[model samples]
Target: MPAPKNPLLPAVRWALAVLAGAVMVLSFAPFGWFPAALASVTAFYLLLPRGRRGGFATGWFYGLGLLGFGVFWIRISLNEFGNMPAVAANALMLLLVAALALFYALAGWLVTRLRPGEDAPRWWVGPLLVLPGVWVLLEWVRSWLFTGFPWLFAGNGQINPLPLLGAPLAGWAPVVGVHGLSLAVALSAGLVVVALRRGGGARPAALAGLLAIWLVGALLARVEWTRPADGPLSAAVLQGNVEQSLKWAPDGVLPTLEIYLDLTREVLADSDVIVWPETAIPSFLHEVEAGLLPPLTADAVAAGAEIVIGVPIMEMAERYFNGLISVGSAADRYYKRHLVPFGEFLPFDRQLRPLIDWFDVPMSSFSRGEAERPLLQVGPYRVGVSICYEDVFPEEVRQALPEAAYLINVSNDAWFGDSLAPHQHLEFARLRALENGRPLVRATNTGISAIIDHRGRVTASLPLFERGVLTGTIQPRTGRTPFAAVGSLPALLLAAAMLVAALLLGRSRNTAA
Candidate 1:
């Protein structure tokens, strides 16, 4: 019945899968070789075996390679900042990586299990249709499942300038969002694989289709999705460059506040809007309102500017929120809705308290803000605000569009240290700017503070671990892109439809045989 399995074949496939996964990391920030993303996915697809178990094994190894190397910086936060033992932190990181790899293993298993019999007419169906759909669907699930770790996505790599190719396809972001671009990349990779296997007959069509997809993307990139609604305003983003080790220390509090306040004063004369990084104040708003607010508000009013700064807010007994407040303007307050698990607040606190206490993380008990909160009004413009990691979720950014003229995201990335995390985080922010057809101003505590235009291009930025102010003019856009209008619904629906079509096609072929 079954042919004898070759012992070396399994070893070769596993090795290829590992290599594919490791190489995929190069496609991300600090080393942005985007073409590698396609190649890595292609290599992984080629190694996947027909059997479901073998497919699972290959996928697991591949994911191990990708996330293991991609997110290695997590250890820095856990060991250096969380005060976890080096050995324990390394082990914990490994455990988390292995668990995340399960999602990829499931995707691989589904691809192999859903394939039609060998005699099926459409040999290209599995790679072209099913695999890409399964891959993107799982990525979407990974974004919100168990609080989500949406990092190092396929589309994030494309945010870097690609000469002709990047500038053109950049328009595709607003139509389908990052998940849709990932699907297109997978489809292109599939076409390349199919062309190699099926010989001359499929090669020309495959090549032509691949070129056409990119060409269309390039043409679409030329289209202006949104327009400026008002005159450009001078905005300044302040990077405090606070050290994570001393940030919450009793003696370090006032100095940290002074660092941001000094930087704000430097730019206030010319800036219409000034922004400070997350938790720049290092104290509750009420505690500082009497002393800090009066002077800051007076300065802003005298300078004829609006100031937005991040500070913690206490609402009820022991219930606090990570929030942003506007001064010398409409006095709007926006609280962060999405909270980071373990980092911002521990889930299942009673059960997990012991483990969390051992790690020694600071401010690990923030309550989430309401999702339907109003936008922050800065001077004449209505701004959408995302705190720290919230910009990574496309849906969160989309929720602020059409009404909010621009966006401001504040983060304290000092926790990540000297790693690729900051670069990757900036890339994610750029995509959000592209997706919503709105300008984005990102302020961080210790690096990658940037001014991104409506097209997702970084116009200016400050170096990492630098105490400085980035001043630039940002145009306020009024219209919404397709993504801002409909959100991820269209992309998710298309992925579902593709998977269903593949299943129906496979069943029909099996019945015929």
Candidate 2:
């Protein structure tokens, strides 16, 4: 591997790193340029310095570019909805982006520290095995650490159902989940960087290895892990398009209830089950039980349909939860287990309360539900329910599988407005469906409400910010995919093994030298 004749200056390299990170956003929703993820990561890999400090700096800049642009919607939620002042919100957004960028910096430092030197015989091992493993392991750590921000994974770009020249890339989802795909993407990028630098026999090997990974992924996409357990169930997903400003207002409560009730009544006759978005009701379940439940339950029973509605629930006055309840035929409830940090429950509230009181986020304080709660039964089928961002966690979704006939995710994406968050969220839902090999019925407020089949294909959908109902049929699947059966253990094990192999190979080469 020869050094460049005219190496880029430090300033130019940093700029390129930032540019590479920003370009990664195109690989996700709204743009859907899937190949850009590989290209962007490749650029980042090529920009990484041989020295540890320089590598960290390069990665930090890349992360700033990636997260700063990708999740800019956080500013929307803070400023527009949370009513945070522009300066404060922007500062907070920058702080969060910088905090998240540390993971990328750590990944870069780890790769540089562990990788073989430029002249080592096993230099190929670093890019092909070590870098991808370190990258994904750090990504996994970031997902759960501090109530993870698990967005913008490299595999997320492949969630689109569209195949590449007749090859379905999303097929790998059922076998390895998103982390494996992220690993593959990182490996490809690293290999590209290696091939570019080492123009020898290593070049062809790296290229061939890259092609093999994609080809295998395409072939894996065709494997069906779960099969239909029952006939398709007609479902009606209501999109009330409720405005965030008016949602909790004193006068708007009744109208909001009326909108959902009317939509349910309209679709009750034709649909087997009707799903409402997250927090569809503005008030507590007990408060509305006397006034709302009787009529709604009666109406559902009369139509021979089940109704699932989202509402806040008060448990013994002091404890409250953001909950979903199924009325009519099936009587069950699920409280959200994974609460969003700051958005749902503020962390370190005692310390931050003075500052936090400035933002006017409603129902921001809620208790997490018990993790071992039973699945909700709707008629003969057992339904796995995820509220809002819970769908993004593959392991969280897997807990209900094997027993769950299908999955239902209820969300209020109106918080994101017309940003890429909703579209990216929908993509997450599709990946969950593919991973679990279960059909997913998603009901969202203000857009991208959809019914996705086990294959991760959107069968039907409702447009964003529209007040309407989407009627679609979903086949209940009973079997589990390899992903569902083993969860992320296999992927984690593979990553660990690769890192071990890289370390051993690097050590052996150093000992010989």
Candidate 3:
């Protein structure tokens, strides 16, 4: 019982574990190369022995590798935006990464405990179903708990090019969210590993299967997920390229209004609607009604177009909302329900008011929006809109679907500067397009303003921080995806069933013993 020591084995295991973690991190891009490669290495590492007690350590190392490498940008936000110094920012980010890594630790424990054995009652089913089930559970916890960081939710990485035929089915994520997709990706990777371990021609078959899957994906991509329905409508997305420092400043107000109007005027002739970046006006709508709104609306209407711009709207005594306004077409507004913690409004700002200036945002307090509203009608078409960070959550977009033919997203990416954050953010929106089977027209203030088709391809896009527009005909979509209708419920139910089955199987095995 002296542990049947194998020194070389321990060293090799540690090295492989570290390498595996590194591979997982490498999937984050710029930070590492080839996510699929790193994912393969990670799949291999997860197969290593942990001997029960060592499971925690194995998981922690794996998490440290996964989050430590993938979320390095957290430090960028803390230092550059939060005004923290490099060391403190790095430490805080590391602590967060470490905390998130615990989920991986939990994942390890579950994986080990749930491994199907010869005597297990549901041994035949456990490997296929139970493993993926637990993965969905852990990923769900990661998404919802702690106000939900939901970044790197596994399936998010699979977007268009991958054979992840499961993307459209995952439309339910808005209601249930990222956990479902994570389960599918984890399960797929797990299947790949299982195929490899069984050896022989299975490896080749699996490889061939993966290649075929990608081919199928490419072919599936050919299918028009959403079609140009009804009459065609022209729209223009106004890119202010407003620098973060001056966006909210008082003097910055006039320049911001001017830039938007100038761009609106330029694109107005060819468009039925023109959109401005999130909170483009910077000033509250009521305050600017006399000076800004009237002229913008009149111009848009007179020139046969509508303007949907982001601005601050006031309600009640002092309540303010980050709102989307329709100036010409319907004269309507949609408030942003999903607020950015600390950036938009501090979570515990009552106690953290003094620290507010640290975030460098003057007006950090804005109330959330209410239930879903009808799509804003401009010209002949009704457009559904989600502002800024709203596009990240699929549920928000689905709320406007069927009612709205085109999905419009307006954002200000000035804060992220030249970081992978914008690309990652755009990828999330693209996935939303694929999942929802809708055309997404994203208009960002600083960069990555893009036109995404139902297939999630960046059909047309403008370079970041450049002050210009890319005009394109957006194909309209009508039908709803399973994800769009039922949301994350399907995935959650599947995960729950897996857990229940695992428990029952374990009990039955004990009874047999």
- Name the best candidate (by lDDT): 2
Give per-residue lDDT, candidate 2, residue 473: 93
Tens digit of per-residue lDDT, candidate 3, span 1-513:
011222436556555555666575444333323345327433533444534445556666677776776667767766776677888878888998889888877877776666655233343344456567766787777765755666666666655333434333233233334556566555566556546444556567656755554455445544544556874556677777888777776788888878877787788888866777788888888888897777777787788887777888898756889888787756777888888776678888778777645565555788888856536665556777887777776656777777678788888777777877787788778877777777888888887888887766788888878998767767676877666777777878988887788778777777887
| Candidate 1 Cα misplacement greater than 4 A, ranges | 1-8, 117-119, 163-168
Runs in model 2 deviating more than 4 A are 1-6, 161-168
Task: Please report how far candidate 1 places residue 480 from its true position, in Å.
Answer: 0.5
Window of ten residues with lowest summed lDDT in model 2 = 160-169
Order of candidates by lDDT, top first? 2, 1, 3
Q: TM-score, each model?
A: 0.96, 0.97, 0.86
CA-lDDT, candidates in order: 0.85, 0.85, 0.68
Per-residue CA lDDT of model 1 for 302-349, tens digit only, reads: 999999999999988789999999998568898889998878888899
lDDT of each residue in 286-398, candidate 2, tens digit only:
87799888888888888989998889999976689988899887688899999998888989988999966887798898998995933677766788889998999988998
Of candidates 3 and 1, the better by TM-score: 1
Stretches of model 3 off by over 4 angstroms after superposition: 1-22, 25-48, 117-127, 160-180, 199-227, 354-357, 373-380
Model 3: pairs clashing at backbone N, Cα or C within 3 Å: 171-483, 172-483, 172-487, 172-488, 173-177, 174-395, 176-488, 446-465, 447-464
- State the local distance difference test value for candidate 3: 0.68
Candidate 2 positional error at 116, Å: 1.7
Using TM-score, rank the candidates from best to worst. 2, 1, 3
